[model samples]
Target: MNGAFSLLIPVYRGDDPAHFAKAFSSSVGEQTVKPAQVVLVQDGPVGDVLAAAIDHAVESSPVPVTRHRIEDNVGLARALDVGLTLCEHEIVARMDADDISLPERFARQLPVVEGGVDLVGTGMFEFLDDGGAIVARRVPRTGHDEISRYARFHDPFSHPTVMYRRSAVQRAGGYQPLGLMEDYWLFARMIDAGASVENIPDPLVMYRVGAGAYARRGGQAQWRSELELQRALRRIRFTSRWEYVRNVSVRGVYRFVPEGVRKIAYRRLIAKG
Candidate 1:
């Protein structure tokens, strides 16, 4: 891809501008490859302070920066669709408004672009409720065949950790509007399109599983979201059982095991192949 990597952060409901700016600086400032641009696509109305923070971030980025604010509140998948149209680079990586990308996130993935992989994801450090403490690290590794196998059963790439080729994403027809698991839908498509994917073996993103960020909003809406997710996965030809049980168990842990540790165990299985 030309000009290093392009980072896209989709904002909705006025995400913390200061945090976003810190994330931008953290991502680009410590990287050697240097990003081509950081595109801030606001999916919804952000507060004035956050808006100013975004502008400041755009202006201050050592690399190029672009900002696009939508008139209405578009969901994450559609927001990503809009941003993809504006990306000039062949490689596009994703960032969430509230999370932080590690210093080496970009530099580690940029050189691997030409290796014929359709997408590459990396390990993650999920933070605690306080954000000061890290709960666990999730690093996934598997050969091409095993990653594809895992994708059939579950999404192998953590959404924020992915660096995707524009053409590969386009060929998969881009993100689906699945509300709850849009990234998972897209990964299933990518695997069908002959896309090879694997996660770099180290924590490349610091994710604050912050309050009110979906998981915490666990009420009627969350339940319905999972119901919708089942239908969405079925559309891609995965068996219904795959969607509800195995996939669910494999994602973020279930019953008792911590999510990050579960991923490490799965990677061990993949590596044995």
Candidate 2:
């Protein structure tokens, strides 16, 4: 809990190898304010090739690098649970295996963390498939009051594009296994626990989207998670059944749209750069 920042990577072995290295170079490598520790935790079962890759990447990392390999595939939530426990710095920033963070991602974030804000997220440019190129640049904004007011509605920040204080996360009881989209659960819980949250207007990272994300979350599993989302929504305020359906329908359209047209629509209507 002493470093200016620590970058945590929770991997399940599906991330692009080059993307991992690029994340470090763009984020940890180029930052004027350096993170004290950069730890990569393999949440899934480690194999020979995966272990070798992580180790090789760590060897040349800009910041002090560390590695932890899980014995089994315990899902991403469990990976985060263990990762949070192992965070040994004051500021903890999350880095997805495939996404590339900007050079100033942490430097810009750390300066604004004063006062009682427990966490901060930033806008992102989507570095998705060739079809879309990039989607709308997303900039999330939710303060403590706004977060509490709309806890039942939607998530305020993109999960991976965030930096959190370790002490605050620990005080809030840490992360739990929330199935596939674990950050969704943690952010909801953080709001419930009275933590202040917000997102910087600047686009600080490149978030990747792909076809499989649609496939996995769209079918029955997404429906089940919708139930979970509804359940979480209920904890904040009572929404009518119609409200539930209406919200789900909107969320569904974004996912259910044909990928081809959807990509074009996103680029023209939303993609900033």
Candidate 3:
């Protein structure tokens, strides 16, 4: 594919400097199809080490890397919104600071985008923070109809593996300020606005997961975000009352359970790949 795309990554204070560097190296430097530009958003003031890491990555990048800084941590949704504006191309790919995108990620997704797919996402492998073996795979539905049907109960696309049209996203109102579920909410809007979407079942990215990753998925804050997402889905008529109840009863309960139980349920029930 000859179409150019920009890679958008948001770095926060909590992100590991080493992981960020490696993520950039893999997603941009080692990609089979390189991005035309890399837009790095400093969500807040990173420490000296992280700042140096960012500088090193930008200086060493094969493609032009643009850095945008936020005085305070405004979270991923807002940071990505800002980064999207700085993208010079119509096609934009999202990457996380700690995830490893396979070499052929762009080579695989870009062609789908060029074929008139407004948004494309792929499956991912979950690896531990110490860089151990791939533990599990999270695969989403690939067909558009299946994706829309699946979105009512679960996020059908892995957020970090998504490459989407800039115009389609903006027309769908860009990224809204939602904790935990911003990507899902934005995608719901995009689908409602009639953007063509698809997911490829290839594990294109290696997602980093710490020991505390499962625990992080629980807690009151996450539960609140889950409730907000369910309400939003209902408001958009994306889900009927029965679907909303099903989501709340099942997904909401998962958020309030013990960390160990949640991990088991996730691996067995949700991330069954």
- Whichever of 2 and 3 has more lDDT, that candidate is 3
Tens digits of per-residue lDDT, candidate 2, 55-137, equal 77788776787777788888787777787777777788998877878778887888666545689889888766565486568
Candidate 1 lDDT: 0.73
Q: In order, what is each prediction's RMSD in angstroms?
A: 4.4, 3.3, 1.1
Lowest summed lDDT across 10 adjacent residues in model 1 is found at 250-259
lDDT of 3 by residue, 1-273 (tens): 358999999999999999999899999989999999999999988999999999999999999998999999999999999999999999999999998999999999999999999999999899988746788998778799989888888888889999999999999999999878999999998998999999999899999988899999999999999999999999989899999999999998999899989999988765756
Q: Give me candidate 3's TM-score against the actual structure.
A: 0.97
Per-residue lDDT tens digits for candidate 1, residues 86-176, read: 8878888888876778776777887677676779888788775464587667767557787776666556778888898988998999977
Candidate maximizing TM-score: 3
C-alpha TM-scores of all predictions: 0.84, 0.84, 0.97
Pairing residues by index, what is the TM-score of model 1? 0.84
Steric clash pairs (candidate 2): 1-88
